[model samples]
Target chain A: MAVSSTALVDEVVADVVDRVRGTLEDVFAAVAQVAERTTAIAAVRAAGRAPTTADLAALRPLLHERLRRRHDLISGIGFIAEPGLLGDVPAWLEWWQNHGEDGLRPLLPDLDPGTSAYSDYTHWDWFALPRATGERAVAGPYVDYLCSDEYSLTLSVPVQHGGRFLGVAAADVYLRHFEAAVLPLLRRLPAPAALVNARGRVAASTDPRHLAGSLLRSVSGRSCGPIPLTLVTALPAPRP
Target chain B: MSKLSNGALHAVFAPVGNLARVDAVVRRLADAIELGLLADGEQLPGESELATRLGVSTVTLREALMALRQQGLVTTRRGRGGGSFVTAPDQPRTARLGHRLADWSTEELRDLADHWAGVAGTAARLAAHRTEPEDLVPLQRSLEEFEAARDPAARGRVYGRLHVELAAAAQSARLTKEEIRIQAEIGALICLALGEDDARAAVVELHRALLRAVRDGDAELARSLAERRVQDAMERLIGLRLTVAG
Candidate 1:
């Protein structure tokens, strides 16, 4: 019994250690690419006409193509008048509720539902954009798309123009990209790593088996050594 | 449920009760019973007996059965008909990274840079601290190769590897998933419009600084430099208009 218990602890430690190391590496690599392209004085100068509607319209297809190429992500983006139909906070929430995956629905109750400024949604708004200049940044620890269960974390900086909201010219890195940083930290200890948004839902997790259903509020604080384990009391226990 | 002499089986599962592991065992049992690997309506040995045979404890074994029961993959009853019976097969669902990057924002992109620089720096520091002196040769070799490479595609490949290695070193799933999201988001974006030359130039400095940090075991310095490198790199993308001007 002692031997087996020791092995279990060992396995848990090993897994956490393994995942943390991975997360670190993954995060560095993913963040490293943020500066791959930029708005050169020449490039921005190339946009000399203040970007007319025709220019914008003509650019969508190419931008979409650009968006598609850069991320290969299911969700796509472009500069639009209304943040696009699904981009609006309320609409996106509603869309996600109705047309999205069940795994994602549980997170909605926590959304503020009042404005477009949720940290997860609009941190890129003028107010938050230039907060970081010639310095470090941690973006979206935030949400870009809710329906897809896509959570994001980024390393970025703001775009500035004489201290004006030149727009948040930054590289968008996905949260999953940080797996290399987080998982290894987790693998080092017996505890699992997960995020529970303010609404008391499982935001993201290492063991899918340890779903929002099985997560316990109590588990959030309990630590076995430095490794923390979420108990099955707070969230619904896994689908047992 | 069947009256299985699962004493041996229960013994086998006693120690492995984590839901995921148990889930797998139940799935296997479902397959086994269906394929006649274990007979239908067979009265298997008791948990102890089963545990003894499988080299697990009855507790773990029962947890597996319970999961199968919950999945409707098995049934348990008391008395003679009280054991575990195969009922349903297992199914799988998964998440993908590509789907994630679609909704990214400028702010989030920057955050990705911060996290990587901090955590990866730590991992490098740890590796430098713990790696055997003799083992440093291959590490140095890998570094040499990375420094020598200049092709964007090659850099991209190296970029992928450096991350996995860092993750393997930090050994955390949290880092791995975060890295996945960042890589998928950036990778997809680059595939969208970022040029090879653009990416290579952006990361070369960061990677080189990171190597230095690792070599020096300077976690803090590694983190700061790595972060600066990432932020500088991210600034490469052009910004979306903050709002549609009236």
Candidate 2:
């Protein structure tokens, strides 16, 4: 029975890892496509000059379509431009998100550097990690009070033009939706299990001791594909 | 509730420790509902599970649930597909706040303020070191909201939110969660003193200065600013309590 349970745990862990990786990869692929299109548009619009905010604004329709296509999984999707790259603004986020039954709407965060309400996106891990490494990244399992007021995971890919770091194309996944999609597999394991980010923060868990957003210490698990997540199965309590 | 909401709910249901068990349980659930940590109409864990989580007897859990029901913070239904569900209470009235403040002794208030100061100061200092200038935006917005608030209750909520955002800027999820729990415990009581115009103005200046210190990356200055702000608020609250007692 113990051997069978161990095999079941391994199978469940692999399934959970695959499900999470598949969902994240879909978002990354969609955002990467958006980035490629953005680069192409920037080249055509700028034509040897710096692209203006209007040029960026023109991509709004594309963002709306992308958001609509993945509405079930993606709560928001858009591009965050490098400061001064658009010529007209110090910072820019041409983002759109689902606003309940009212459908998708543009995210107009405060951008003025002098104001208290400015939403400087430069420091956010989703934007910063990809920009720094020039690679795709997954940021969070944290409450996203700024956009959804829901716990979220933001996947992003750096948008580059001729090796010049332009910005990032990103998508927000509601952690609730992610959980709804992934938790059943976790529940299938006989032992307590969890999916944790590289930072040890639990993204989802069947282990009551390791609740989501809480850090896991001395965790052991297998990495979930290219994403920095691990599937950890806790040993069940021994019988008294 | 989402799984993340489950994490927060766990904090709400954490063991009641050695306090008046039933009362502590009631307060924990009540505060979570009022603070919007528990969503309206959200189902709580089953009684057995909840009892185990709180380290209370089923009987004690029932008594606390009954108290919550009377307070209109929770409702229970019978039969299948039924469980206790949260019903967010209205904002605690100002008179109720005075009564709540009266419950705390001067020494207890001082101790609470000390803890608050320690947490807020650490958060501010770390935010100064870790955040970019742009990351201060949410803190700035919270400050403006506090200044524009027309009533004491609104000011109190915004004040708590500002500190919570400060922890968020520090980029420590644990700190942010701690700030939320602390706010739920003492947030409403602070409204007693924030109602005064002079007190409000003083806080506005302190918040502005704190923001500048964090923006300039002066970690020690930011920590001091944060500590002073909380201590000042505590002093005002203590003065009010004395006047009422006299």
**Best prediction by TM-score:** 2
lDDT of model 2 at residue A5?
65
- Full-model lDDT, candidate 2: 0.76
**Clashes per candidate (backbone, < 3 Å):** 152, 0
Global Cα RMSD, each model: 28.4, 14.0
Residue pairs in steric clash, candidate 2? none
Q: What does candidate 1's lDDT look like per residue over B1-246, in tens digits?
A: 232212112212233334355544554454334322244345555677666554556787788667656655566668865765544343420011122223345576567556665655555554444332322333344445555664433333334445544543332445544554444334323322224555555566566666666566565675566556555555653232122121
Worst 10 residues of 1 chain A by lDDT: A91-100
Q: What is the DockQ of each candidate?
A: 0.01, 0.04
Candidate 2 differs from the real structure by a C-alpha RMSD in angstroms, to one decimal, of 14.0
Per-residue lDDT tens digits of candidate 1, residues A1-240?
122366776665455444543433333333233222222221353445332333333333433343344442213222211122221232211111111232211123223221111113333321143353444344333333322223454434343333332233233344554443344444344344564432233434556655321222334422222212221212344533
Candidate 2 lDDT tens digits, A1-240: 222466676776677689878878888988988898889877786667788778877778778887778788888998889987887777778888887798887766545422222246676778889999999999877556455546689999999987889999999998877888778777776767788887666788887755676556566888998998888876334223
lDDT of each: 0.40, 0.76
Tell me the interface RMSD of every candidate, in Å: 22.6, 10.6
